[model samples]
Target: MSDFFIDIIDDDGADQGQEAEVVSGSSSTWKIAIIDDEESIHQVTRLALSSMVILGRPIEFLSAYSAKEGFELLSSDDEIAVVLLDVVMENPEAGLQLARRIRQELGNHNTQIILRTGQPGYAPEEVVITEYEINDYKTKSELTRTKLFSTIYTSLRTYQHLVAMEQSKLGLQKIIDSSASLFQERSIREFSEGALLQINALFNIHSEGIFCISSGPLAGDRDMIVAPLEAEQHRIVAATDIFKSYFGKAIDDIDDITTKQTLHRTLASKEHQFTNKYICLFLNTPSQWEGAIFIKGDIDEERLDYELLSVFAMNVSLGLENTKFFTQLTQMAYYDMLTQFYTRHGVIDRCLNTAVKNGEIFSVCILDIDYFHEVTESLGFEYGNKVLVSFANRIQSILPADSVFARLHSDVFAVVVFDDKPLDMEFIAKQCAEAIHVDGDKLRFGVSVGVSQFLPEDNLSGEELLRQAEIALKLAKEVRRGGGQAFTPSLATESRGRIQLLGELREALASHELVMYLQPKVSLIEEGTVVGFEALVRWPHKEKGMIPPNDFVPVAERSGLYYELDMYVVEACCKILSEHSELTRIAFNLSANSLNRPELVDDLENLLARYGVTHDAIVMEITENSMAKGGIVIDTLERLQSKGWLIHLDDFGTGYSSLSYLLDMPLNAIKIDRSFLLQLHDSDNAAVLLKGIISICKDLDKKVIVEGVETDSQKAFAMDAGADVAQGYLFYKPMKLEEAVDLMKKQS
Candidate 1:
């Protein structure tokens, strides 16, 4: 092996292209401390070490006759990577004490120490090496020039490895912490801001920049940049301008888009050797969130940073892509992409299709925009589409719990109202008509609604019932602007008899024929836990055993009783809960009517307060149908959260349930529709679907309630699938409120 001085020479050589200062000729400089009473010993030590060349550099030996003088030299200069000590100096064993002080008091872990003792007995090799933490100990006579170089070489190399390890550990920790913090931030802006701060601290450079780009029409368009004052202006300019310009065009391309190479090359600049950029392109479609491009300045302190930068960029890109994917998946499944309303398909699957065994009365209402086609032509298709979405949003806000609202057709929307009292469908329709007005202040156009009471006759099919309401809607339009018509047999007696019935159904809810029923949700786990009960509305015709909600719920909502129906449901639920305080709690299904009311949340709060029920115990089940339609639903749900109601996204995996709901709403639990569970046995993808739902709910920190588990296998599957709660025939069907209370007492 080369002499110890040779290794330092190799490292400090100008050829290394590092910050290495030259102290002498080709000979390497060594900081040697000579401590001896004899001046000759100092001279002799210097002469011997001077001739010794480690690598291409000759050693420059330091000399001191006393330990005190040697300490002074050591204290003044820390560049002495290695120190040589003498055992006998101004005081015996003085060298040994100094070595201990260097290791303990000075806390210098990088410097290497070697002790040379004239009198070896003063400090034994074993004792000094173990107790004093000195790297090496040698008798003066035995330390030849060759042996001395060997010992120094060993100590310096060990120190180098230790320093490298410490730096590696620190770097890894910084990366982990930054990644974790990014995941915790709620918005992209917040994540970017946090990352900027962390990267600045980690690199110890004032210059930091973040430029993000979103692709496509639906995606957000923005640009932001931030940097420290001390950071070079030219560096920022090159990084920001060059990097952004390069990625901007590349990311703009709709076909064959990628973040690799094309964008990464632009990040190369004077301040940094190489940089990494990533592009995540979202699929072209109607969605809340879309494509994203992230570019980061790369500072390569280590020679291996090229690969690390690539890995970092890849990770960031993947995260952004995953978020966008989740968001789009939710929208397609839960909402009406065109008008941002609950699609007809989603509402029926989640809300209207509930397992209603006993005869129950629900109300149905259908409303059509008056002269919508003319409005579309006059306003331009794009503006018309916007107005339609906006109009749907307004009407959606007023829907009540137990009511499912949806855009049934291009110009028609349907709502199923759940209420105990007779709903004034005319008033509900008029309120919706006003909601559709443009600019909130202008009466842009009128809306006409057809109403129907859910009679057993309506149970034939959801389509037939909706058709009946549409018939009523025609009568409403015939009357005048903003006129609401309820469905009646005589109304149907006209050419568009369904339209006639819609005109009369509005009169029926006012007479109070509609009644309310409560369906109990029992919890198998957590003994005595009823969990909650669902509020169901029923209509008892003087002749029919019970009218099905499917038949009439839509009529009331479309005819304008949606808001009143919501109040009725809330009032009845409160009464039931008040009557059965010992039961776990009660939940009510809500329609767009109640949700749209500016006073809805406030009213619910007051009712809960009056009933002495805490918000925690009261859950409002909102169908994926209503959630699909955006606007007031988002704001209303947020307001309801502020008021303390536990809002649940009912029929979770069945609607346009875009990822926004997971992040935006404070949903306590999600109920898996019974259909999804039933399909589990029929389709090969049953387990996969169920597992996906469970995983999403678990990740969002919400509970999952499986709606149907009739068979033993279904129950076992639900349990194994990690369902938090189960409700079906296997447990118990929707029974009378009194029977539910009796069962709860027995279970308790």
Candidate 2:
């Protein structure tokens, strides 16, 4: 051991019989405990710290004779900010034990401990400093006054930093708690209000703010709205104390034009703006829903999350997005895509909520554009869309805001008007129909309205109420009524019978109970030789007798069951071809719905393979309307032709019979519609049209088939027009497979 120096230190760490210099700074003292067995070490520590000050605070040293005494002092009083200790004290490892006790047992991690050793080799300073949690390691002789004061100042600085961090952590926790509470609010108003409050709490600063939304879809072509309406549409969803009265109000409605322009500009740029007057953070809500927070204060947000308002702004954005999405989803659940009016489902929802539950009198008027199909046929779909939009705008504009208007079906609008007293449904229907009849350009097309009233004592569901309205609509259209017809019990009975017929029809097709009848197509050039057969589906009902093709085909097509019916006919044709080798080729008709189905190709492949039939044995007769379905349908025809199937453009004289489809499609034949053959009796225009069609087909190297040849004159007319084949009742009416087989065998 080095020769020990002795100098006594009192309890207050004052040197005995030695005057110590004092610092003049009047600040709180940093209590530093000196733990050592040697009195000389404590005396030297006190002398070094005697005139020293850190952060304007004077240093105070507490003297301990041994490690045990230092532990007792630190345990009783937590004010000791630093410990200057000797490792080899009363016990060789006593200082080490006390350092561990002060840090671990006393849990005084905030205080700094320095380990001093008289004999440098007694214990390794590095090991003692690390294991015992000592802040600094120094031998007694090396601890000069300047070095000791520097160490104490450095340690004091570290302790002050820890306390400041603790304060910040508590403050951050408060903000987290506030932000977490915001999610529970459902509406945008409540959510933004909560978020604004949290932002204020985050900074502990008072500020005014508002949330605005620019309306549009989150993810769609934003151009759906007219450009003029884009900037004109925005609303304040929430606001601070200053703008509270304007919550849920449109931005345009506010008198503050400057603020409105600022908001619009901010929404347009999608950027945050910060200045002394205010800081604006754009909350990027999905779709065109533009929202932001405007804080009116000079805030130094360095203590908070560096971008303090951004967090609450983001929360408000997400929350408002969720609420708006849900709101739009609710609207869409009951509204039409094109008109922004309620659909049939929407009307039903309204009825369930109000009309059905209350005793108030309400009438539903079902209106339709008269001769709408002709409108679409004469003009293209673009013009038709314009017509629909115009009609919806006119009707909606004329009706009271309280009235529920919905697009119940294509070209049909259902309006439910509410009245306290009993409604004269007929007068109401007439007035509504006249409104539509004079409604803009739609007046040229005219309109028919059907009125239905809720009958007392009959608890009707929304579906039943709408069904009654539909009955009236059909009645008015059929009768060509001046305005509309009111619903009657007889119409409901008729509708029920139709429904029953539809159900039976579906069952008959599913069970293959319906029979396939063939109408012979004879070669006009050969005079009597049978060339091919047209397959026609016949529904022979047990009770109702033979149901006319005119009856169920329209109903089936209207109800979206035409594809199934067409597919069934194709399957029957394939089966007939497979069953009879004499039947060389079968021509069958397919509607627009069947043609557009993407699965048609796959389904055809599977059906042909299942029946072991070749594609060449089948002829697909598509209507003129199907040709207008654009390139996809034409492509399908080409693909079918490539696979050896013959494509015939049936009803070729009707609809948009563009020379384009005739040239573009892989057509094998053009079947003249019955209208052209019938029209010949009225004028030579029919003869001229038929001859032109045949000449076109001839030039294209395609076959021509004339239908509706009922008399010898008509057949002669067709042959003269260069028709290769003719099929009509005058040759042979539609016959079942057995009859057709016998007729074919006789002819053969």
C-alpha lDDT of all candidate models, in order: 0.60, 0.72
- Total clashing residue pairs per candidate? 80, 1
Candidate 1, run of 10 with poorest lDDT: 229-238
The pairs that clash in candidate 2 are 218-287
Q: Per-prediction TM-score, please?
A: 0.37, 0.48
Please name the candidate that would achieve the greatest TM-score relative to the true structure: 2
lDDT of 1 at 110: 64
Q: Pick the lDDT winner.
A: 2
What are the per-residue Cα lDDT tens digits for candidate 2 across 455-507?
A: 54668877888888888888787775546777888889878877887888899
Error of 1 at 427 (Å): 37
Q: Which regions of candidate 2 fall more than 4 Å away from where they truly are?
A: 1-362, 366-396, 400-414, 418-450, 454-463, 470-491
Regions of model 1 farther than 4 Å from truth: 1-513, 527-529
